[model samples]
Target: MATLEQCMTALEGFVGDLAARPALSGLDRTVSCRLTDLEQVVQGRLVNGTAQGMEAVPAGPSVPRADIRIITTSDDLLAVTSGELSFGSAWASGRVKLEAGLRDMLRLRALL
Candidate 1:
């Protein structure tokens, strides 16, 4: 049971790394990360590859539609940050789900 704070810390680091990548420098998008196990969603807007306003949203179906969506369990989220699991592996194994448009997918190839 990973807390939202733990997930936010890990995600800030991940997004910060993505923001620093030259390959992602021109990318801008909004993202939603859903922790299904915890029934929580964190939303953020990315401008020039830097993420901002990342915070937990009230659990609901109605919210601003994100350009990218990431769905995963809270335990897996914790595992990835704790070095107990690899993101690529988890994604490949269907433990993590990433939904994005083709263009965004191409731009995000470097991170995912």
Candidate 2:
């Protein structure tokens, strides 16, 4: 099992990549990543195709209301980062869950 720290690292790297994608350009939205197994939440915002203000916060609505929410386990997170698992497969298999508004959903589909 991966630790929460490891998951956070991987998530940051993943988000960094996502930030550079053209699809995210000019988008300004809050995103929350809720790690179920880790019992933690990491929050950030997308601005001009870059993620900013990302940090772990106590799990709750105290963080910004998310336009995109990603729910998954630490192990699965590390797997995806290490390429031992695919995001699409994990999501399809119910190991990963994503919640977002309709526009955000359409936007997220181009993420991975």
Candidate 3:
């Protein structure tokens, strides 16, 4: 498992990468990454091609679902963000799970 700080850093980099992509310029959505092993969630909103209000909170029923939800372990989160693991492969292997509306899924598939 990755430390909380490490996971936060990885997510920061992930958001930075997403923000740099022009294809996502018009995309606006709330995103949450649930770290299973750590039992925490990193929540934020992706707007204007950037992520805002990124924060980690304990995993529980009180954590509201976002427009885009990602569930995975902390180490896997780091690996995916760092390019050590491909998102598609991870999803296929059941290491990562993604949930979203059909339209959002289609739009995100092309960029994520």
Candidate 4:
């Protein structure tokens, strides 16, 4: 099983590759992950085609930022990273929870 750091690294690589495409250059967003049963939260910003790690500060209210929140167990993370789990199917099956604004959700769908 991959550690959270390893999983994060993989995700970073994935996003980096995706951001390299000319069509994806303008994407800017924030993603927050609260791993199931874990106390740590990972927050980062994807801006101007680069993902910059952000301080793990609590989000303020009324901020106009597209936020993607994911809550899943460690096992689920492993499954997702290994391609053994499908996010759409997991989301539909209640294995994952996603909350986002409408436009954020749409942009996330396009990016992913």
TM-score of 3: 0.93
RMSD of each: 1.5, 1.6, 1.3, 4.0
The candidate, 1 or 4, that scores higher on lDDT is: 1
Model 2, position 19, has a per-residue lDDT of: 71
Worst 10 residues of 1 by lDDT: 11-20
Which digits, one per residue and each the tens of the lDDT, describe model 2 over residues 1-112? Answer: 6777787788888877777787777888887788877778988887887778888876765666688888888888888778899888988998888888988788779744
lDDT of 4: 0.62
Q: Candidate 2: misplaced stretches above 4 Å?
A: 61-64
If scored against the real structure, what TM-score would every candidate get?
0.89, 0.88, 0.93, 0.69
Task: Identify the superior model by TM-score, candidate 1 or candidate 3.
Answer: 3
Q: Per-residue alpha-carbon lDDT of model 3 for 27-91, expressed as tens digits?
A: 88888999999999999988887888999999999999999898999999999998999988999
lDDT (tens digit, per residue) of candidate 1 on 80-99: 76778987888899998889
lDDT (Cα, 0-100) at 112 in candidate 4: 43
CA lDDT of every candidate = 0.81, 0.81, 0.87, 0.62
Candidate 2 at 64: error in angstroms?
Answer: 4.2
> What's the best-to-worst order under TM-score?
3, 1, 2, 4
lDDT per residue as tens, model 4, 2-76: 466765765665446545666657877676656554544556776787767843333355333337676676567
